[model samples]
Target: MIRLAGLAVAPWLLWPLLGAFIGLMPAPAGADDTASSPATLLPAPVAPVPPLLDRQQVDAAIGRLDGIVDAAMAKTAIPGVAVAVVYKDEILYAKGFGLREVGQPEPVDMDTVFLLASVSKPITSTILARLVGDKLFDWDDPVRGHDPSFALSDPYVTENATFADLLSHRSGLNTGAGDLLEDLGFDRETILSRLDQQPLDPFRSTYHYSNYGYTAGAVAAAKAAGEPFEDIAERVLFEPLGMSRSSYRHTDYLGHANRARIHVRVGDPAERRWEARYDRMPDAQAPAGGASGSISDLARYLRLQLRDGSFEGEPIVDAGALATTHLPHIAGRLPADPTERAGFYGLGWNVGYDDLGRVTLGHSGAFVLGTSTAILLLPGEELGIAAITNGEPIGVPEAIGSTFMDIAQHGEQTVDWLSFIGGFFAHEFAVDPAGPDYAEPPASAEPPRADDAYAGTYDNSYYGPLVVETEGGALSMKLGPADAPKRFPLTPYDGDVFTFEPIGENAAPLSAAQFRTGDDGGIASVTLEFYDRTGLGTFTRN
Candidate 1:
């Protein structure tokens, strides 16, 4: 893990197996080709040819999965899990394990809802393909074609940016650019408006994992479809796929049942305890990571993709367009490894292969305090597995997906997957929440000035404005728009620098807060940093 601004940056933390799958990247060759040159694409996807298993074999596999899951839960103290596996055209198995909420007897079920996190990217990609099939806009069309105001700090790339560029994460923006605004309660349109102010990377020269880029793509798609993003998804994707329980809006989950509660294990191993989190993500970035659904609902989605964009024999999007979605749009950098080639970033999915040279595609989604989701699609074996857990991730979903693929592809005897994969992600199990490596504010510091001294609003060009107020003799900060936006408690650490106490486990772990002083010795600006990346912005006193 790379440390950025005193925080451990694990951009690849969620994509632990991506490097191993680099060998399975597929080539494309088909009609309805949307690429600038289809001939340059990889060969067509290989159809799944794994041997079919008898009910006895299937039952045993399910039993093994149950044992692995149960062991993982007990060892990690994970609260609950929902898993669904599809082989060929059949729902091979779907089951829930453990409790939806720790200490509660209710078991997680097929319909239990978990946040899809970045897993929403692939769904967003499919939605883009559906719109392209409808002739809403060409995949390569300039992003500004749909939203004339769309832009980056660099005018050249901004003028040349395309929908595919945004979706493929080649838009030259830093990873998670414009995310601070989302975390601060800014709405989608506002986030889009402030995007130009965020920092950029080398133009199309690196694989910067970005959620804001997808959010921008969604904004453009919304413009092209002449409808809200959620509405477009509902009409074009969910309604047709029969994803009755899936929704991008938080309001839709208000009274929903069997919803997974976000749980965090705090304290040391001896005294660690699971705690529920109440923090929520901003709805504006729904296109990026704001999706919630069950394993059953996601199984239908996987089935659609497995059938090459057809749903129940009806064409949702043309096969060629779907194929184009899976093709790598840009080179993705991975550490130099003798075993795997440099990876590539596709539209939403990471395009690559397994060691056996079989095509593999997948994505992982992580909710900071709650759940982790993994979806692996092995087109070569007509197999797909989606695993979601209600507790903090301990490689449950990835291990399950990998084990399912191994069973279908290799037909091997059951392996101790819990111990095998858990060993790879041991740091996850050994997370010391109270360790100094965390971004918590130091307890030995006091403010250099009175609390009211720093009370005021600060502004940024691209991230919008932030308000710092003194409430109850303590300093608090709020960002963007909200009825009563959540506040971060500020504790002074060094001269003119402070740290914020996180509100909840899911809330952004803001590390250091520095107040730039004017020549007059007054606070002139403020800057904040998070574990995910660098300092957000220099918010000047308004």
Candidate 2:
């Protein structure tokens, strides 16, 4: 799992995109070449090689889905889940389980919309693939050619990075760069404009999963199409595929009548109580993590992917162009142990090879505020499954998809996948107990300076101006855009160090604001620990 600004991105979610199947070695020379030999000697008719899983095996797997989903929900206590499985050209199963909300009477059905989270990455790639087929722009074309405003800290990278480079997360931006700005109420344009301020890793040689970096590529693609990404998605892919219920706009999701309300676990960690919260708004990075749709709508998408960019006997996107989106463009995860397999990332999907050397494409999506979604495709078998859950990620969707794939290929699950995956999620989301207990201050702690001394305007190029003001004898800090700054009331932890509870999706529970003094014994700078991921959280006192 990747942790940025205290937000945990599921490890599986970090994997993305697809690639071509590993081909068989060619037959020895002089085997059967009718063209080189006499016309009378014809080669024997060859039988078609069977698929990895037969119809009977697929049917048997579909039969066990109900039990798999039922047991997962019962154990996790998630509010709702919608799952759809597509095999060949048919929808093998599409169903929804549990309530739309824990306390609501409306039950989740096949049409119930849920946020797709990072699963939107593949959908974005699909739309771009359509544009590529139309000759709008090639995947390797430099992004600046399409959008003049696009840039990174490194001028060379800014001018040379391609759509494929950014989409595969190899442009070298720090992991989750620009995400904190989004959490701080910064809009898309503001966030995009500020990405040049972020530090890079090692140009195209580094793989750091960045949402805004991916969004930058999508935004550039939209510019090349001369339309917003949402409109392009509908015009190029959604409408053509008859996915009327799918949308990249957060407003459309909110307007949906049967949408699953996002639910997060509240109360003690052991208690596991859930509460519905309408807080996450991912429109800023829509191309990377903002998509909402139903299982029925996603089933069609799986069919298109399995059929190589074709849907319902019609080619919506060019097969060659779409295949580019699945080819491994960069190594995403290197195995820590010899037994584990290395993972690769393509345009917007995770590419991996199974034991049989068959290509497996998958990506997991999650919002800690409450949604979890996953899609896994076995292209060799023409089988794929998509699952969306309306609850905080506890590995429910991934587990469901894993269980289904196991049953499809092996005829039975090899292990308790839910427990195995859920344990990782639990550990990732667990609060770190190493930090200081802000609620209890040490009796020997030194007192803070006068409120007026700390009350001043501070400036940071990356995060903008931060204003510390004295309010009713207490100090408070405001940071973000001037119009809508987020205010955090400061509570003194020690001399010159105050603690405040950070807010928003990427916020840490408690962050310290340490005031630095100059030779004059006056505040010179303030350092915010939570906003310092790239070492740019310090603000000079103005």
Best by TM-score: 2
Lowest-lDDT window of 10 residues in candidate 2? 20-29
TM-score for each predicted model, relative to the true structure: 0.85, 0.91
- In model 1, what lDDT does residue 478 have? 80
| Tens digit per residue, CA lDDT, model 1, 99-135 | 8787878878988887777788889889988988888
Please give the TM-score that candidate 2 achieves against the real structure.
0.91
Which has the greatest lDDT?
2
Off by over 4 Å in 2: 1-50, 433-439
Query: What is candidate 2's lDDT per residue for 1-542, written digit by digit as tens?
Result: 34433444323322321111110100011111222211112233233234678989989989999999999998978989999999988998999999989898999999999999989998999999898889898887889999999989999998888888888888888887999999888999999999999989997667888899999999999999999999999998889899999999999999999989999988886897778965589999999999999999999999998888899889999887787776666767676765556677777888756655566688888888898898888776788999999998888888888888877777988657787777767777777898656776778999998898899999998899999998776789999888999889999998999999877766678778999998899999999988887998999998
Clashes of 1: 11
Candidate 1 to truth, TM? 0.85
